[model samples]
Target: MRSEFERRHPGVRIQIENIPGEGQYVPKLLMMFVAKKAPDVMHLDASYASVFIDNDLLLDLTPEIKSDDSFRLDDYFTNVVDVARRGDKLFAIPLDFTPIVLYYNKRLFDEAKVAYPAKGWNCDDFLAKAKALTIDNHKEPGKKQYGMHFINWMPLWIPWVWTEGGDVLSPDGRHAEGYFDSDKTIRAVEFLASLITKYHVAPTHSEAAAAGVDLFRAGRAAMHIAGHWMIIDYRSDGIDFGVAMLPTNAASPKTVVYESGLAINRSTKKRELAWEYVKFMTSAEVQKVRVSGGLAISAQKEVAQYYASDEQERTFLNAVEFASGPWGARVEPYAVVEDLGREMMEDIVNGTPVPDAVHKTCRLIDLELSQQ
Candidate 1:
C-alpha cells in the first residue's frame, strides 16, 4: 500500500511510524506532538478517538471532503464516520469496522447434536445449551471440551452488560459511579463469572493458560463471543463457523461497533498530500483489497456488500444498525475505565463477591474520573 501511494506521487514518500504496542501508542503519540514531529497522516481508531478529538490533534476534514468532487462522506457508514466528529466538524475517513458477536463452531454443535444459535436467543437459552454441550460426552471423563470461551477483555464482555440493560458509564460520559455499580450491571457480571465458576461451561483463566491455545480456534469450544476479525483466523484454521447476535433479556440486543479511520495531523504542513493519501486509502478500490482477507467488514458500504460472501458476513452487516460505538470514542480517559473494568471482572472470576467487586471498581473509577 505504501509503495502504491509513493508510486502515484513522485519524490513524496510515506513514512510509516508504528508505536508497536497498544499500551505505548497514546503516550508516544503525545510525545511526538510535544516534539513537533507527529506524522502527516495517522491511522485513527474510533475506540479511543476522544484522546485525539478532544485535544484538537486532528484536522477537520469536512471542508476538504466537501470541496473534493469525487468523494462523498455518505459512501462510508455514517455512524462509524461520526465517531470522530465534533458537531459539524469531521476529523477522519473510516477504513473499516466490526461489531462484537457470538461465533459458534458448527462442527461442535453437530457432534453434540445441539442446534445452532440464532440471533434472538436469550441468556437463559444460551445457558441451557452451554450446560448440555459441556457435559455431552459422558463416556470420556479424561477429554475436556468447553461450551464457550471467556476472556478478561473488558471491551469483549461489555456487550453482555448492555444486553441486560446495563452500562459502565453514565450518559454524557462523565461518571461511572451509580451506573457501574447498578444492580443490572452487577447481575450481568455475576452471570458471566458463573459460566466459568458455577456452571463450568466455560474454561477458567488458568485452564485457558494451561491449554496454551484459543479454545474456539482449536475447535474445543462450541460457542465464543468475538468480532468479525476472527473470520480470518477461523478461515485459516479451516474451521466451520457462524456468527450470531448477542442474546438479550432487554428490549433489544446490543453490541459495540469498533472502527478505524485515517486522519490528517492538525500540524501537517503538507495537508493536501495527506488528504490525497487519506482519500486513496478509504476508496472502494483500496477497501476491496483490504476486505478480501476477511479482516473486517468494510466501512465502504459498496465494498462491504460486494465482499459479504456468506451468512456470517451478512450477519455482521445486520448488526451494524443496533451496534453502539465504544465508550472510549466519547470518554477521554476510557483506557483507565477499561483497566478498572478488567480488574473488576478478574476479581469476580477469581472468587470475589460480585457486589463487592462492582462497588470497589465503581468507586475507584469515580475517583479516577474526578481526577480527570
Candidate 2:
C-alpha cells in the first residue's frame, strides 16, 4: 500500500509507526498528541474516537467530504459512517469493521445428532441446541464438552441487551439509570448468566482457563461467539467450524461491531495531504486487498464482494447488515464506562444477583457520566 501510494505521488513519503500491542497503543498516541508531535493521520478504534473528539483533538472532515465530488461517503455502510461522525461532522472515515457472530463446530453438532443452526435462528433455538449439545462429564465419566463458550467481554453479550430492546445508556448518552436496570436488560443478563449457572452449557472462567483460551479449537465447546478476527486462527487450526448470525430475540436481531478509521490530527498543517491519505487508505482497492486477505470486513460494500466466495465469509457479510456500534463508543470518558462495565461483568459471574449488579453498575456509570 505504501509503495502504491508513493508511486502515485512522486517525492511524497509516508512514514508509518506500527504500534505493537493494544495495551500501549492509545497511551503512546495520546503522549504524541500532548507533545504536538502527532502524525498527520492516525488510525483510531471507532470506540475510542469519542475520547479524541471530546478533547477536540481530531479535525472535522465534513466540509472536505461534502466538497469532494469524487468521494462518495454513501458508498460506505451507514452505521459505520455514523459511528465515525459526531452529529453531522465527520471526524474520520472507517477502514474496516467486524461484527460478532455465532461460530459453531460442525462435528460437534453431528455427534450430538442436532441440526446445524441456520442464519435466522432465535434465542429459543439457541438454548435448545445448546442444551442438547452439552455433554456432562458425569454422563460419560471421561468425556468433557460444553455447548457454548462466553467471556466477560462487553461485545459478546451486550448485543443480547440490544436484541432484547434495551440499552446500556439513554439515547442522549447522559445517564444509565433506567436503561441498564430495565427489565429487558436484566433478562438479557440473566439469560447469559444462566448459560453457565442454570443450564451448565458454558464454562466458567476458571474452567475455560484450564481448558485453554480457544475452547472451540480444543473441541471442548461446540459454539462460540466472536468476530471476523477469529477466522484466520480458526482456519489455521483446521477447526470444522461455521459462522452464523447471533441469535435473535423477540424484539430484533442485533450484534455489536468493532471498527477502525483513519482521522487527521486537528493540529496538522498538512490537512489536505492528510485527507488524501485517509481517502486512499479507505479506497476500494485498498479495502479489497485487506478484506480478501482475511484481515477484516471491508468498510466499502463493493469491496465486500471480494470476500463472498466462501460460506463463512458470506455469513460475516450478512451479519454486517444488522450490526450496530455499542453506545459506550459514542459516550465521553468511554474508558471509565468500559472499565466499570468489565467490573460489573465480573460481579455477575461471581454470582451477584443480576438486578443488584445492574443497579450498582448503573449508579457507577451515572456518576461517571455526571463528571463528564
* Runs with alpha carbons beyond 4 Å of true place in candidate 1: 136-142
Candidate 2, residues 1-372, lDDT tens digits: the string is 988988988889999998788668878998999999899999988767777877889999998898899899988988887777777788889999888888999999999999999757788899999999898888763356889987777757778888888888888888888898899888888888889888889887777887755778888889999888888888999999989888887545788888888999999998888888899999998887767767688889888766778899888877777888766458877677778877887787788998999899999989988987
Q: For residues 286-353, what per-residue lDDT tens digits would candidate 1 score against the true structure?
A: 88998788888889999999987789889898899879889888888998999998888778888899
**Alpha-carbon error at 261 in model 2, in Å?**
1.0
For model 1 the local lDDT of residue 269 reads: 97
Candidate number achieving the greatest lDDT relative to the actual structure = 1
By summed lDDT, which 10 consecutive residues of candidate 1 come out lowest? 135-144
What's the C-alpha lDDT at position 363 in model 1? Answer: 90
Which window of 10 residues has the lowest lDDT sum in candidate 2? 136-145
Structure candidate 2, residue pairs in collision: none
lDDT of 2 at 126: 96
